[model samples]
Target: MNALIVAPIVLPAIVAALSVLARGRRQRVGAALSLAGCVGLLAIALALFAQASGGAVSVYTVGDWPAPFGIVLVLDRLSALMLLLNAGLALVVLVHALLTGVDRKGWHFHPLFQFLLTGLNGAFLTGDLFNLFVFFEVLLIASYGLMLHGQGAGRLKAGLQYVVINLVGSTLFLIGVGTLYGVTGTLNMADMGLRIAALPTGDRGLVQVGALLLTVVFALKAALLPLHLWLPRTYGGTSPVVAALFAIMTKVGVYAIIRTTTLIFGAQVTGPLMLPAAIASVVIGFVGVLAARGLREQAAFGVVGSTGTLLVAVALFEPRALAAGLYYLPHTTLTVALLFLVADLIARRRADHGDAITPGPRFASMGPIAVLYLLAGIALAGMPPLSGFIGKLLILKAALAHQAAPWIWAAILGTTLLAVIALARTGSTLFWKGRAGEMRHGAVSRLDLLPAVALVVLLGALTVGAGSVTGFMDAVAGQMFAPRGYIEAVLGQAAVR
Candidate 1:
């Protein structure tokens, strides 16, 4: 179990190093190595998921040292589920990148992709705040490189914005960590939780401020409300494959919030800050989607709206409600990524027109790509017979018992309606309408379409298997809410008490 826990992190780092070593003329070999790493990661993630689904928590202590001191990695149901989702996404996106010939655009694409995987896997597994921050930096730096792989003025500009915003967020992360260490005299999450539980009332204000700062940083990464200015522009500007891979990046912030609040800070502070921010994000996302002039921008805003809806349930801090949110997480992530890839596919066919979402050239082999975009649009709007519908249903049903049930229902349902309208507009303009000028009949490669097709099929599978998945999520929720077991795993048994 310990080996499995450590393998996901180490495997990627090793592959990344190998890929980097195979630089220049050996870049083809590097891409192949990265692809192999992605496959291995998917297998390892699935194995971990299977192990954790049995309601066990696994821990790996670095350097054979004890907890609250040495580096530690912990895997419970939540982390395992995240690992599987991330690995699956990365694998599919890598295939898409290879198909699109984007992997060869720069010498470092393969190595950077592997390094990004290393960081993502590490962030999910790390049990301490310091290492979490370390993993975040690793991923961010790799992302900066990937974002600029194609090297356009627009992309470079967006990359700069991304770097600047994240640097500020990273600064806040360090400040929060420093304050946390000063207050609790520990960097270990479980130990921090124990200390926080017994915190002196006089110091509560100081700790709260520090925690709030951290929350803001995570929310920024999560793209909650006003902080979300970077998302649509950044995502829209990046290469389609890179954009698809970034689908999981935002969720890193979501993961941090879940792990830290439930395990360390409790939801008392989080709920208050997150609630209003989520509502605002929902409003802004819907507005942006409605206002979008292109398919890519609309999809970017669609992602933001979905994030808000996911966080709405999460902010409530109800176990069942959060399980619903958890279920929604992977579904939304995959759907949004599929949207990005499809947008790029359609845009590439149009060439200079570039997914304008207005009447344009009818793509050759329009049947498959058009069908995909249509279905993805429906799913993104939370329409019936898809996982999106089921996910929203779960969230709404769980929210019905809350005091603010009406607000929750009205807000979610209303924004979903707007989302439908926005998607409808995009679909009609892109696929249905015909343009005046001579159409560019660029041949659409079936290989480029394969990954998106697989994602759509998986969305269907998720819908059909909702019952089993939700049950597992319920069990995972049970493990998540009570942190004693998690605390004891890192510390000795009864150490937290």
Candidate 2:
């Protein structure tokens, strides 16, 4: 169990080091090795999940040190589930990158990808708040390299904005952490959680302020509403494969928000205040989507809106609601990645013939591709029988059970309508219209087709198995809310009660 907790973090780091040392043909070999590492991490995550399903928690202390003094990795049901999702997504993206010849273009890509995985795995497993921040920085640095990976003017320009915004967020994160340490005198999350529960009511205000700052930092990363101005531009400028890799990055921010709200501030001062903010994000995100006429831009805004919806579910803080949020998390991540990849495929095909990939009047003529676009559009809009529908239904049911504010209901309805209209407009321009110039036909490479097919198949699987997945998500949610199992594993029985 201890090795399982450490494997996800250590395996990636080891592979990344190997990737950095490899050259030429060995680079591809390095990439293969990295993929193998990801597979190992995925298996370990699954095993952790199985073990945690018995309502137990597993803890691993680095360098054989104890909690609060030594760095600790804790895996309960929530962490195990998130680790599995991250590893799976990383594996798929890595495979897509190799199949598309991205690794062949640059030696650095594989190492950076592996390092990014290292950060993600570490972030999910860490029981220390400061260590979580350190992992976040590691991930951010690797992302900076990946975002700038082809080194073009557009990429650099976009990367600058991405880096600048995240740097500010990172600074704020540090300040928040410092403030938290000052107040609680501890950086271990489980220890902090216990201490926080015992703090005098008056001093809770200081902790709430610190939590709010941390929330802002994470919300910025999640690209929620006003903080999202950087996302569409950044993602729009990057290559499709890089954009796909980033699909999980933004979700990591949302994941942090969920973890913090549930474990650290559960039913505390931070949860209630976040609800209205979540509603505002939902409204703002949908409006942004409606305002975007371009396909790439629209997809970017849709990502924002979906993230906002998930955050709202988190803020609701009901067991069923958090369960809905958990279910929605993976669903949105997969859908967004697929949509971005599909957009890239269609655009690349257009570019091959010296035609504009950006949707114009000419795109309406591509009927077969148009169907794919429509399916993605429908899925994004939460249409029935899709995974999106299942996620949204769970959230709506929970919202009703809680009898949430009328404005929240209004925001959800309004956002859905706007998202539908925005997607329809983008689809019509890209798929339904015809360009004025001569049409050129080009072969769709298997590289492109493979990702699209895999995405569709995965979505289909999710749709068919939504019942079982939701049940698992619900169980994880229950584990997260109480988290006594997690506390015991990290601090032993002496520290828990």
Candidate 3:
């Protein structure tokens, strides 16, 4: 179990190193190695998920050091779910990149992708705040390279802004970590939680400030509301394959928020600020969607709005609401990523227009592409018979128990309506309306469409298995709220009362 717990991180790191060694003229070798690594990650994630399903919190201590004194990795239901989702997403996106030949744009793409996976896996599994920050840096550094993989002026500019903003966020993360460590004298999350629970009265204010700073950093990563201005430009500017992979990056922020709120600060300290920011992020997202001039921009905003929607449920801090948010997480991530890839397919077929909302030459495979867009749009707009609808339904139902239920309901429903309108407008312009021009690209092969189709199929599967998934999420949420087991597992029974 210990070896299994650490494999997801180490496997990707090893693959990334091998990929680096296999780069240049041997790019295909790197791609093959990357693919094998992703497959291995998926397998390990499945095993961990299965182990976590029994409600055990698995711990891996570095150098055999114990408790708050050393590096540790912990796997519970929540982390296991994230690991599984990330592994699946990585595999599909890698296949898409390989199939579509985006990987050929740079010799470094495969290695960077693997490194990004390594960081993501580590972030999800780490048991301490400082290590979480370390993993965040690892992923962000790799993302900087990935974001600039194809290297155009637009991508370079966006990458610059991305680096600058994240550096600031990283600074704040450090400050937050330092402040918390100063107050509690520990960086281990479970141990920190116990210490914070018994925090001295005068030190409470400093802790609150530190927690709020950390929340700000996490919220910024999640692209919630005001902090979200960087997202659309950044995502829209990147290649579709990279953009698709980034769909999971924002959730890293959401993951941190969940972990800290549940494990360290508690909802009373974080929920109030997070709720309002989350609501505003939803509004801004759909508004951006409505106002978008290009398909990729619209999809980027959809990610923002989806993040907002998920955070809305999360900020309520109820077990059921968190469960709803958890269920919504993967659904939205996949849907938005689907939109990005589908947009690329459509854009490739349109000469000189390139994902613009305006009418252009009719692309080959119009019928199939339109169908894919329709399905993605429906999922994004929270329409019926898809996981998006089911996720929204669970959230709305869960929100009913909160005092701010009316606001939550209004934000979700109203934004969903706006999203529908925006998607309808864009789809109508891109697919329905036609202009006199030549198609630059040929028919999209089955292989070209396979990644998007797989996402569609996955969404369908989610809708079909909603009951079982929600049940599992319920247990995961229950585990979060009652985290004594987590604390004990990490620091041992003697650490907890």
Which candidate gets the maximum lDDT versus the true structure? 3
Instruction: Report the lDDT of model 1 for residue 398.
Output: 90
Off by over 4 Å in 1: 435-439
| Number of the top TM-score candidate | 3
Q: Write the per-residue lDDT of candidate 1 for residues 234-336, one digit (tens) a residue.
A: 9888887898899888899998988999988888887877877887787788778888998778888887988998898889897898899998999999999
Name the better of 2 and 3 by TM-score: 3
Each candidate's clash count: 0, 6, 0
Q: Rank the candidates by TM-score, best first.
A: 3, 1, 2
What 10-residue stretch in candidate 2 is worst by lDDT? 352-361
> Mind giving the per-residue lDDT tens digits that candidate 2 earns over 422-483?
77877666665757674645544555456666776777788899888888888888888877
Ranking by lDDT: 3, 1, 2
Clashes of 2: 6
**Tens-place lDDT digits, model 3, residues 210-313:** 99999999989999988998999999999989999999999999999999899989987887888988999899899999999998999999999999999998
Output the better candidate (1/3) by lDDT.
Answer: 3
Q: What is the C-alpha lDDT of each candidate?
A: 0.88, 0.78, 0.92
Question: Which stretch of 10 consecutive residues in model 1 shows the poorest summed lDDT?
Answer: 434-443
